[model samples]
Target: MSTQFLKLVQATRVPPLMGPKKRAASTAEHASPLGAYLLDARAISPGNLAKALALQLREDARLGDILIANGWVTERDLMMALSAQYGIGFADTALPPHDLDMIRSVPWELCLQYTVVPWSQTGGMLILATSNPDKIPQIRAALPPGLGNVLFTLAPEVEVLKAIALGHGKALARRAEAKVPERMSCRNWATSLSSLVVPTLCIVLIFNLLFHTTMTLAVLSLLACALLISNVIFKGTALWFHLTEDKSEFHSHRDHGSQTKRPIISLFVPLFKEPRIAGPLVQRMARLDYPRELLDICLIVEEHDIETRMALARAAIPSWFRVIVVPDGTPRTKPRAMNYALNFARGSIVGVYDAEDAPEARQLHAVANRFAIAPKKVVCLQGRLDYYNPRQNWVSRCFTIEYATWFRLFLPAIKRMGLAVPLGGTTLFFRRDVLRELGGWDAHNVTEDADLGIRLARLGYETEMVDITTHEEANAATWPWVKQRSRWNKGYFMTWVVHNRQPIQLLRDLGLRKWLGFHMMFLGMILNAALAPLLWSTVVVAFGMHHPIMTLLPEWAVWPMALVFTLATVLTITLALVACRASHLRFLRLWVPLTLPYFQLTTLSTYKALFETVRKPFYWDKTEHGAFGGAEHDVQTPEAAGIERKPVIFGTPIKDTAPNIQALPDQLTKVPVIKVGTDGTIRRIS
Candidate 1:
């Protein structure tokens, strides 16, 4: 279910089509392809199908006892792929298609399932055309020895199933896989009263009764409220993460030529001045799952950003992947680029990703799969994002943990709580028509993802998490980190502004519980992160054992201060525990105490964002890499905890475009800094 694209293999080796042969059952020359055009007689490679079948056969013990176990096909496909990979006898196609009888209405995927090798010394090409390619390997691996690389898969399931039972053992006839349940039970009991809920409730009730409604009571309510709202956000993010990791429903649907498989999808990649990322991302268009002719991959580059346009052209992408050079004007932000991109996008489904993303190979597959299962209302799938190299320093590790919790636990829980999810910057897949109906990304809103999520909720379209994640590089250094964080904070502030533009409509749509969650998750993030320093300062004095415990105030004053600070501390501690547990950072439990002091440190970013809001509302705060770094932070494998960094970074320093990749066509090796003598080319700055 690569709701988009799971793999984009650059197939440079497909050979000539064999001449059509008359099938006993159907005409070979003209059959409508049921899934993708890969169903044509010339499409399937017998070597590939045999490889898929052999892989499946080795795994199923029950199926392992069939004709395949007795040297039927003899793992020939596996040997072929290996041979091709190893450059062993990788011959130019010596055999012509006209000499062989070509089979049709079979999908390439099905051919692989049954070991129906496409290119052979034999005189025919067997095509597999069933919608459920998953079933192909199942039947093929167990086929009897004499049937080797000779069977063709049919598009109609009834015929395919019959053929499978005849070729394979009768075991599959009795098997029907169970459908997955829509909802799972809450695994952890945060609602249970025994551990702390009952005690906290009793204390709050007693305090209210004794104090008779004071500021202290008001504060208690905020604490309890934050606990509830954050829980929802945290859960939603985690679910999306898990769903992306599991099998998608997009791939589960079987086609006996049923009319449901081909929904159109539109993809958007918005770039401002990022020419460095434009080509690699555009190159990824070849991997999409939807028909290449049907899909539209819009590359939205700024009108003035000429380099990105040139970079995209260097790849010479097909018409399906078009470049939309946005006209230069005021309000140059990502949402603005998206607004322009949406105007030209043509598909039933719509999606948007950052220019720097290389999502999981099967990200779109997951989106497609999820959409297939939850077709009635699941129109959008927000993918999770994590820097592949997040541990470049203490800040990046912290950012990774924060993102892991936000996307994996918080956002999903928010969605479950019936609140809108604020999508991350990349890999957002959507239904194109639905997006147009909603009026596309908001031109005025700064954090377009959050704004659009709210817009979806308003329109009654529910978003499900696709089992996909995008790999991004974290800001390489500290100055870069602060700058980047500042931009994000500013955008969230702008989101708060634009959404509030229609407050009455929101209150009506979200109701009380959901609106509360929305405010706590989004609004609360801004306030708490900005105000933590002032709120937590008093508590630190009491918590630190080394500090002299002095009762400076008279007896009358000390009691209330103690109780008030204690409650705020509880509020702080509770949310901290929730966020930590949500991210599965049990190792960071020790660091929690250490992190509290620094939690206030994040306040500086908020302040910077606030001041910059007026001057640069949509500024791209470039996060630099390589700060707090000594040696290279690259690792062959992912690390649970360590300073991680993707050694390669793209683009020129954010401030300058003259000397970077944008200058690729130029031949200058180094800058001739000064034209000292007015001679045309030889002056070096040094």
Candidate 2:
């Protein structure tokens, strides 16, 4: 027999494989025993086979997957051994040319869901190639009719996925870009424009008809003061709830039974121009305590992002990790990439993480355990996020304190109040079925996380907060921080506009109390930051400086305004300090008072966000990572992996090396063929 199994190992790829040395064919080639065949062929040692079998029983995974994940045998070798064992054939050569009609016969979505691709035609029968031959029966049953007789061929999972993408990438991109209903999407320009334009014009017209320009301005200033006070009051209520609530729920740990079988969990780590962090990312993910066979970590990269692709190519990616190359398309945002990658996930649970995240080791176990015990309506679990370099600088310190206050105190309080929880971007896990049923995400919404949370609530789903945390890099620098904050604010503004487009419907979807809370959270956040200049002008009265609105205001209004300002300040400081203490960051309590200056930075970011909301609503401001050397790892440099580093130019057109795209000849080359029946009986044809 030829050394066909060795073709499965790709030398230049990350997580380099060790192919078995060529030797004589096994004497038991005609036998149908997988372990015995591999051992006879010297494909795997006996010890590795025993270990893999034990893991297979423990994880409830396939023996092949366990061995492949552990690097004991290549995927191709396993498939080839299975071919010999089951009397089937292996599709060892390059994939055939795109048969558009054949591809159209079966839905690519179904193909992705089952890991199968209609490869080619032979003997008037369709040949469906799959990485998972064990699922052939299910795939056969689920496939749409009209393709006469079908046969199955074994191929590597990655190769099958790449072929499917190459054939249907554009369609997938288009669908992913607009998966959310048009009514809920911000992509509808007319609706977005009317939502913003009508509100502003009416407010202005009302002011013009009722009062003079100066009085109108004073009224607007007073309105800003009122909204700020309302926000303060709302937060105070949430703070009270947080203080009064039992701490046991906040710190409780999920008990994962010793013998409980954990389901597979897939995490999507989206990367754009992030070249340097790939090595560290792999290092961080390797720390996860989830079983190797059950952990599906896909590195989501754009098809044209050659820099990141090269970085991934250099890193030592494990055998189980998948690099999903998202086809280049419009509004190249993170959510869109995730939506496209969602089809390829192999887990019942799905999650998302940024490139720089280092989640707790037992985070997956906690999520799985919680999901196992919690009600089905609890479809999502959001983990707390902190900064890995909290004390890097004053900016970092303030940023950390802000996060502590929100994730540790305010968000939990909001959840307890039964309001829509605007999800943070990272460390969020969801039930796969519910996520798909909701059509994934609005790709056009820059803040897809928050939008998804609201959509879940509208559909009567709940998102519980998991106690584990994932530490991320803090944006310590000034310019980067502004850009990042602006993106988030822009997302919030867009989410508010989209959800409020049909205000009556929104009110119906979310009850009166939640509706009020939603407005207070989104609109209040935006207005407070946008109108901070007006509110800050009142500080001049304290210093006896000439103040515009404060001097013109009546005594009754003045006293209340001064009192509200003092109360807001005291409440904010107290919440931040208490949050720090709870989060075991008591040292950051001093930085709480310093956050007053930090809060001013959002004024600049809010204006920038407003500008971007009008100009480019879907543009994602990619935050560059590796600034503070994440997670304290001594990672390998790109040069060490034989790649020269170059400065990344934002928005530059990426060159495509476009590897492994060779087309096979019309006829099969040395690959055997077979005939399969509707009942999945295999009969050798060649």
Candidate 3:
């Protein structure tokens, strides 16, 4: 049945002319006469053609792409028309059988890059199939010399993709599994774990044996205090900068011309075991204020995650949205899934979002405009992330205040100081080329975003913080929050290890100042969390409670240590309060004093993180989403919550108009059938 289907599909293809070389299109062909052909065939209305033509002028895009983007014409129809116009044969419904020899002639990366694959050989000519005709010339230029005669056929992108997946999915998946270079990856840590550990443990043991136990304890205490003080000072500086930053620059960004031609932005929302959020995810994405025609959203799911695939199939997926099934591979991390799905993305600017994200309406527009005006070296923009369910519980309120502190104050200060900005997993946009050049992300690194940010700095690219905010579901429960925080801390440890593998080289790449900042950020964060209890113990002295550490510290050291502890406490509270105020989360202000106790939870997470770093470093501790009823259960809009309209970034926060999400009958009775098989293939089964 498959062979017969292939044969029938092949029959529609018009093979390129029989020649050693095909002639280039005539001057008239560049004028996009395909629109007239579509009109004559009645494939698209006259008004649709005019609209696409107008967009073509502004976007400088292909008429067929514009038409297809608008959903004015089916992709198959566009390919058929292009086939007629160019005299290239159309590869219908399913692609013909692959020629392993011909496929081997081209590099796997090149095939994915151009969206073309070798189909079969006939009459001393190799027939190549492609979804994108514009890439043909580039493919031709890249082909090996001995592959003498070649012809091209136009196929619908879905068919071409299926062919590629069936033929090379394993090889591509393996490559994606380890895109980061070996020295830069912590994937092989299992081998070197002992080598990296034994020496450090031996030195500490030797020191303990040489010195008296009390002296060793005193020394450790002093070192921990020094690290704590330095980390606190850094946080203080960042907070001070945030308080005094000139608002005029942000004001200018708001008033900057919006006439810049907007590019198609692609977003990858990686989902694993997130079935519950699929419908809500679609509804949230639909609220984006960008042109539907230009939005390309790929909801990526692991091959084994049937629940998510089923959930997505049951939803009314917009034409602009695509469901990408990631082939199964090791590590099974979000970055790995994104690395595989990146091949299928169709935009020059790629962003990432999580399953439960609900970005402000104009966020994409803000991103496009900022990218338009930003310098070429500014390759990344990290947006602010907040929570919509901050009022859910004590955990959520504390989470909100912590996020406000990080995004509003800490990140902005880091960017201002020319330090590497550790990227948050979501609400991040990057230049596709630079992202690809950096090898996407370290699949084995649990905190791929933070690792990538350091890599960006090492490569001399800059990351700027944009004021745009994306509201998401905060982990409102206790144990779940610990698991999530542990995963993040574990990633930080791995990132620090990978980057510092070659300290002098990293120092040269990041420079002296940034090198220090990097240490303070990663090492300091690790220390602060891991040694938080050390400082917390000092607080007992204020309560006049007897503490064991008093025996180790001299009388002179006691007063200074107490003073430093007090200073750090004040700085932390002050920073959190300022960030909370800046976020306009006035109701959470009363919770600021309790944050010290709140952060003790992180100390527990730090132990778990340490244990996991040695045992399951690559494991992605999945955070469950849609745990709290959000937009559907709460007041519909931000205004309804009594939130004032103000520029958090560049524009007023838009109202959250809920999407029409009536559940469909079982088996997706009323919806178009978008089937993702266990092998990770998407088949439109209408």
- Assess every candidate by TM-score: 0.52, 0.82, 0.85
lDDT, candidate 2, equals 0.76
TM-score for candidate 2:
0.82
Which residue pairs overlap in candidate 3's backbone? 14-89
Candidate 1 Cα errors over 4 Å, as ranges: 1-259, 283-291, 315-320, 540-598, 618-686
Against the correct fold, how does model 1 do in TM-score?
0.52
Tell me, by TM-score, which candidate is best. Answer: 3
223 Cα displacement, candidate 1 (Å): 10
User: Per-residue lDDT of 574-634 in model 2, one digit per residue for the tens?
Assistant: 8898899854688898778999999999999988988787667778887889877573543
lDDT of every model, 2 decimals: 0.47, 0.76, 0.75
lDDT of candidate 3 vs native?
Answer: 0.75
Q: For residues 1-686, could you state the per-residue lDDT of candidate 1 as single tens digits?
A: 11111112223431112112312111232221110112122233222222222222222111111212323223233223222222223212222122122222233234334433222232432333332333545755654444446432222222333233233211211111101111110101123221243246458868875876544444543453344345444544445443454333323422112223434466887776565555556544444433333356777777678877777778657545666666565456666667555544445667787666655543554565456556566668887776656545565566656666566556655566567777776778777667666656655345667767766776677876554677666665556667777777766766564455457777787677666666765767777676454344444545542211223223354355566555555544444455556343555544444445444556778888776655555556654322333113231122222212111001011122233222322422332222112211112232
Clashes of each: 56, 1, 1
What lDDT is reached at residue 183 by model 3? 85
Off by over 4 Å in 3: 1-30, 94-106, 120-126, 134-137, 145-148, 193-195, 202-211, 258-260, 540-554, 582-584, 630-686
Model 2 ranges off by over 4 Å? 1-60, 71-77, 93-104, 141-145, 190-192, 195-211, 256-260, 540-554, 582-584, 631-686
Model 3, residue 659: C-alpha shift (Å): 30
